[model samples]
Target: MCRTTLTLGLTGLALLHAGPAATWLPVVRRRLPGLAGAGDADHVALTFDDGPDPRSTPRFLAELDRLGCRATFFVVGETLARHPDLGRRTVAEGHEVAVHGWRHRNALLTRPGRVTGEIARAADLVAAVTGAEPVWYRPPYGVLSAETLTAARRRGLRPVLWTTWGRDWTRSADPDSVLATLAPGLRGGATVLLHDCDHTSAPGAWRSALGALPGLVARCRELGLRVGPLAEHGVS
Candidate 1:
């Protein structure tokens, strides 16, 4: 009986970790409304997570610059400490900079108080450096819990998740594959998730996302979809 109960409990917990499960989980869906798609009409929000990498980030910045597009970079606090300049450049370049967390931690595995602290510190650090308070927060790996959700709301931060992601964190991913994954989700009013660094991903996986971005931007223009930060999605 003990083993059966444990097994069932684990199964439910695993289900909650699923990114797609946000649709079925009311507690998450209510507090995290951006997961399914755009909050506004006519534009799609482009957001990158786990970044501020000096190596890979500059290239992404350049590409967006060339295309006259802007994205939100949800930076990890720990990495930001190591590369404050990259974080600053993100802000300088017209992209929105938001907090991912103090570290890339799973909220479900962390205590509620600790989860709050993680976001608080990250938000403070980001604001201190950028002179702008991040209005949005995205948990690491897109995983969330009731504790994290409440903590985010308490800090005056809105929790957001993506409607479409390129799965650019894997070594197996490339520009074509990334574009393929994003194609189906490419529609007006979608939140697109990609990565700018590989600090927590396969080495050099960030390149896949970087390579696919121009095409993504072009396609958006072709479809008459404007690509910009979450602010355009009315996240703030």
Candidate 2:
């Protein structure tokens, strides 16, 4: 009976964790009220979230520089506070820096006023670093509420969503698996979601998503896809 209970508990936890990725709303196809669909042309936009880490972001930027690609980075305000120079470097490298919220908080859980504060504060910080307010906002974990969207719009930012996600937040995520997840929709106008930072800390630590970069970029090139900044596709 105890073993059975343990198994059930583990199964429940697994389902709870998997629910977010499976049920996340696809915001890419949903048109915001005010924006016109100029649409993307012959290119895919690469975006990274929950970032500005000191250990991993520099390497990610270096790889982007080497590949001659520019990506959109959605940075958390608190993390930006901790790594201000890294945020500056991201802009200096010609990548777009957008807001991921303050403290990586779930937008759904936050009150409208609080959400406004979180987004506005983050946008201000990003502007301070890069000299422009962020024009795009991607909610943490892809969770959103109507209030979140309204607040973002009022701030003059558009809610940008992903066409593909790698679940790169997982420590056990295989680079090949990440590649496979993104293989199908990797045509023009695709926004690929990845992470430049892993919050986990361990000896000989792994940055699972960052590990998948070279493989993913090579695959994009092999398919004759252009990878560039999200703004180029008129995402905002």
Candidate 3:
């Protein structure tokens, strides 16, 4: 009976930790606009994850500069620690740097206290490198657990998930494919997810997202939408 009780308790804990992950569902995201990163009707929030990589991130920076647009780069803590110059450059380039956790591991699968500590550590690293406190936190793979939410709150970071993604991490992804995947949801008030590096994806897959930048920005302008970072997105 003791073993049975212990098993039940663990299951309950897992459920509680994973329940908020339901927000990943399209319907749930549509209903919870704020959590889904919905913002101003005339603006679109451009967010990139798993980055500050030396291999591919600089190319993304150059592309954004060419387009005259800025985006939020959700960087991994450990990666940023290794490339503090990249982090500094990101900020200096008129882009916003946000937390993508200390590592890219999902919060639900991380051991207790690990996710919490990492969130704080990552936020601190961003502040240390950029000299500005990051205002947003996006969990790796968009999974948010109970502890993840608590940690974010304690750090004064607001959790945000994207409304649409380019699926640019796939091995088959390319510029046109990335644009096509994101086309349906490209609208004002939509948060579009792209990746700046392939740290957790098919090697060199970031090219798809990089190649799509110009077209994406052009398409948004055609729709009379403004492309910028989440700070300008007016999330409320």
lDDT of each: 0.79, 0.70, 0.86
How well does candidate 3 score on lDDT at residue 229? 98
State how far residue 54 of model 3 sits from its true place (Å). Answer: 0.5
- Stretches > 4 Å off in candidate 2: 1-21, 24-41, 200-206
Q: What would the per-residue lDDT of candidate 2 be over residues 99-119, giving only the tens digit for each residue?
A: 888877555455657887888
Give me the candidate number with maximum lDDT. Answer: 3
Put the candidates in TM-score order, highest first: 3, 1, 2
| Worst 10 contiguous positions by lDDT, candidate 1 | 1-10
Score candidate 2 by TM-score against the native: 0.82
In candidate 1, the residue pairs with backbone N, CA or C atoms under 3 Å apart (3 or more residues apart, or in different chains) clash, namely none
The 10 consecutive residues of candidate 3 with the worst lDDT sum are 1-10
lDDT of 1 by residue, 118-198 (tens): 898899889988888998888775665666667777888887777788888788999999999999988887788899988
Rank by lDDT, descending? 3, 1, 2
